[model samples]
Target chain A: MRAGEIAGRPVVTLDTAEDIAEVKDVVFSHDHGYLVGFTLNKRGWLSGPMKETLDWSGVRALGPDAVMVASGDALAARDAESGATGDAEDVVGGRVITDSGRELGVVTDLVVEVDEQARVVGYEIGGATVEEGPGGDRRYIPLPETFAVSSSALIVPASVTGFIRDDLSGFGSAVDEFRAQLEQTS
Target chain B: MTRFAEAEHTPVYSKASADEIGRVIRYVVTASEHTVAALQVGGRKSKALLADWAHVVGFGPDAVVIDDEEHLRHPDSDYEQRVTAGELDLRGRRVLTDTGYEIGALVDVEFDESTGELTALETDRTSVNGDGLVAIGPYAVIVRQDAVRPEEEPPAS
Candidate 1:
């Protein structure tokens, strides 16, 4: 499932049949590329700060509207560094610059493989020219050869710039190319 | 695959007679497995049917080709749950880091056109860290917080 759909949906408990909280975030394993659990934000102003994270095992089912859990007990606090979620990083809006300091665009989205293993594989870059209008272009870049990130900026080598594609179908082609290159190197 | 954003409203045609059956609606995937189980078609508000993946023949650029109308069936409980929870669309969601920094909103999603499998997410925010993806969920698209740098803009003089 795309992460956008369930982000703010209500969380319900099965036993008591109560609407407990709204899903604030979806946590997953970066390495395994699978959903791990969900973090809960309190319902109202009076609820106070509650640390409730429901692991994947705790989920009974994901329906069209609300997420069903076995019990309120399923909502418990989890260590940020634990398997409850992979290393959480915010990349969208981070600046992209080549090793030689040529600025690209801001990261607007990511293309994740959502089969059995849901891992992030690529990114969409919206450069200044693309963001100037409604019909502006978006460039798709495959996961690069070497890149680095800081809280503010995303850095990649110049060689990776050549792999950018402007459309979703092109992204598929780029993935194929990258996979083939990997096989050749190995 | 096309972005569900782009795939939405895409017409579905029957291979038997090449008749326009319905337009694309949304994809239904299980929460645990994250695998697309079916495609909800005929439109979002109308009495739509779940097009089981088994009968899906192709995800063409212009239209989705299906075996026949017989493959379209009423959605079951599993499919209903994901829809009620709004797990189908990941576009326009927000992004946050582990350090509690709010990044930006998601704008696009990439998918395998052939299998209708989701491949990636695009956000309004910029990134150069290659594929520094960490996790995604209802709250935010979390990446490696340590690799994040402060926003590049400087204070006005």
Candidate 2:
């Protein structure tokens, strides 16, 4: 569990355990450094939120590799049928964390709503971007648009063709669509 | 937009009030910094003049942040997306990195949805020194010089 070494592992129940899928990842609250849910790799292929979720209190132990959860039949997580946050984030940093090896960046800024809720909407990957420019200045990038590339470059979604559109820019159309999509959801 | 303009964003929030909406005090996080300082359901990041920011940014310091209210969807929907996932290539004006190691992870990113400017990148863990912050490698710093296509999100298992 040095770092970024558990991205593809599966969390399975032991022969003696009846419930508790082997933890695939640990999804933390994007804002606070608290454990949120456990992704049971076995259940991630499910359709929707039907995936099980271990309440924040289900965690039993924290280590470099896996966060030990209370073994039980009801330990299913909301996204167990889906996937979730990893242990690397909990053992070392908080959510919205990216670990390739030992590189760590504490989230200092968050782009949220202009309303009272001000809920987190995106992150400013400045910790590592600071060295990507002249004099090593940090460059802002979005998470949905970013992806780890061999732990070196944090590529944005724009760089990846077919993922979205080429001319799409700004929050106008996408924002409207994003909002519209949410309206159609819950 | 300053150095990290993406982090400093501008979103069109509903002209709604949280005064009696039964609010849930949440946190103000950037694109990558999922685990930020704490949770405060004020109007803006500037907790000092929260009263003023409450009016412009939110309804009050207690409004609820329902996805329907803010139109947030999948995965931290409330969190702002300075950039889109399809546009990671630094073709149109993009900031460049130094080390060119491409081994570190992209903890998070910032975007200005208003003008589509990506300004900040939060790394998982970095060593920011006189030469600037680089990905924390076991022995040295990890640098990213070029853009790489994001691989398909593999199955969790």
Candidate 3:
């Protein structure tokens, strides 16, 4: 499920089925790729901080237009009111760097799997110069590699660079090699 | 197999009559299996059309051929409508193993672009190397943990 789908949907209590608030941003574990919970804002309008977060366990049902929760008790304060910002960092524009310091490109998007929870699986990267023009060479980098995400960049190791393929289909060999390398080094 | 991004705008046709129907504006992928469930069709002067993968009979380099235009219809069920409405798109959704291990976010999907048939989901090394997609839902993607290769261990001190 795209993260955008859950945004702005009604957050209802299970027992009361009351529309308590609206879903704001889904807070997920970047490392584990699962839903941690959801941040909520008052229904309508995009102003104000999201003070409440509902854990995934509290979610009873995810419907077409509404998110059903067990109770208002499921709601928890974020960072205990210290103004914890949501993960809205448009990492799409972040730079990509290799462990050997070769600059690859910028992060265009993240590929995730949504089953029991949301998890990040890979990244879409492309050169800054070729992004908008035809024939831009975009590539996908799978997870479990030596990579780091800071304020404005995503860094990977040099070994992972060999796995970079132009398209998903052609990347099969690269994926197998990367997996093999991980097993050997482990 | 074709990427979701490239699958957009691929020409579509009717197999029975071999008449051009429309271009694929977008796709409706299933949440659990990570497969193309339906295609949203659009073209100049044509009414909106949604065709399920079940109706597709063949795929070509230039076109996706469905049984017939009579097979196209607006999604009727809430689940199907949600898929058609982009509410259940798994393209960028995150995934996890049944054991709660972090897999990664879904980056792309590989499928028969012309046939609208889903083939596989590419999430990350864990999900990619796993047996296959076991479940796909709004919450998370689940794969066989046993199928997952062990992560690179930190060097022994």
Q: What is the lDDT of residue A88 in candidate 3?
A: 28
lDDT head-to-head 2 vs 3, winner? 3
Model 1 chain A worst lDDT window (10 residues): A83-92
lDDT by residue (tens digit), candidate 1, A75-162: 8788666742432236567777777988878777655544333455566778683444433577766664333434477675555567
- Against the true structure, what is each candidate's TM-score? 0.41, 0.22, 0.41
TM-score of chain B of each: 0.66, 0.23, 0.71
Count the clashes in each prediction. 55, 90, 32
Model 2 chain A, poorest ten-residue lDDT window? A159-168
**Residue by residue across B1-157, what tens digits does model 2's lDDT show?**
2222222222323445332222223323321221221122333332211111222332222232222334322223222221122122112221213311222344444433223233444444331111222222112222222222234211221
lDDT (C-alpha) at residue A14 in model 1: 45
CAPRI verdict (incorrect, acceptable, medium, high) for model 1: incorrect
- The digit string of per-residue lDDT tens for model 1 on B1-157 reads 4666877878988788787888877776443333456777775445658787778898877898889976788766843645634663556765443333445676765667666554554568743131334444544444434434346311211
